[model samples]
Target: MNKVELVYRELLFQALEKNNFLLTQKELSNLLSMSLSTVNLSLKPLRRMNAIKVNPMNLKTINPRKVLLYWASVRNLNKDIAYQTRVDVSISEIEKNIPANCIFGAYSAYKFRFKEVPADYSEVYVYADSLDEIKKRFPSKSGQPNLFVILKDVNMGRYGKITSLAQTFVDIWNLGEWYSSDFIKALEMRINGILE
Candidate 1:
């Protein structure tokens, strides 16, 4: 993820997920290990969109759903995929075997967040620092990749084992798979349910 995308993820994770909307640029810089200027630059578009309001000491999102939709529109999921390979195993088995550093995303993320899914999904997406490590763990290959290892950004670790709701939505929306819309519909309801 680029710095701006990272900023968006942080906003969603902190504000929407954690219910902490009082964020200062300095705090963001400190937490993200980014320069003050970069954080400022990242917030500019959000300000223009009215998704966030910039104050003297802090910034607050006015419409998180707008911010999320904006991110979904811009996110390039394919560019983030570091590695893709087929693993001959059940999806649960693949989930269980992934390295600790990897954060489950997409369908797996939905399952983690909601504890259920509308239907079964074959793919297991994860964000990891090193694709080589994942490859080593699941060495055996097959026809098509049921496993997608996305390159992890520096700031992504804060969300822990599963991708944040915003991250999961964006990733699944970008997938363009047959079942992606189903996941997106379910996720939208879940997100709305939380925000309400």
Candidate 2:
């Protein structure tokens, strides 16, 4: 990289040395005290060199080790970006293994068909068809995005874990006479997993 390119790379790397892996282009520009265009121009070469992969969204990530190296080379700043990267990877794995489509709602169903699941069962459940669907549907999870995938099709969003309380009730009511009474009762129990 050229002198200007290296300098800008250092600036970008320095800002990401901390635990905050989600750095925006605007934030990087602000921290580097350089124009956004300058920052973007400077970053272009490093990215071309395979040092960084830009995801121009609310949450952007890069290779922490390379970033820290650039930081040290330019500003003599040493930081362990590996730890943050590890955490991000680990969190991603955990979010990938949840189930899809179950436990939507049960308000009227609760009072009429299955009055077993207490009001505490008020949370609405969100599920998906697959993991790729999640990344495709919601690229970056921003503030209160209200959507999370325990793994692919399995999700916890809107209300997190459960969707709106209202939806949960509606689903239960709709399935009232469809499934067996014992089955619905079993669902009220945390252990009853039909998907399993």
- Each model's lDDT: 0.88, 0.38
Candidate 2: lDDT of 128?
44
Model 2: how far is 88 from its true place, Å? 49
User: Which ranges of candidate 1 are over 4 A from the true structure?
Assistant: 140-142
Mind giving the per-residue lDDT tens digits that candidate 2 earns over 1-196?
Answer: 1334333443333433233445566776665455777767766755765556678573343554454344334431111011111113332232343344422223322333334544332221234445464454345533433233222121124233342232232234333244434433454342223112
Model 2 whole-model lDDT (C-alpha atoms): 0.38
Q: What shift in Å separates residue 12 of candidate 1 from its native position after superposition? A: 0.8
Q: Give the CA lDDT, 0 to 100, for residue 137 in model 1.
A: 93
The best candidate by TM-score is 1
What's each prediction's TM-score?
A: 0.94, 0.28
Model 2 ranges off by over 4 Å: 1-17, 70-196
Q: What TM-score would you give candidate 2 relative to the actual structure?
A: 0.28
Q: lDDT score, residue 36, model 2?
A: 75
Q: Write the per-residue lDDT of candidate 1 for residues 64-176, one digit (tens) a residue.
A: 89889989998999997878888888999999999998999999999987899977899999999887789899874768889998888887888888999899999998986
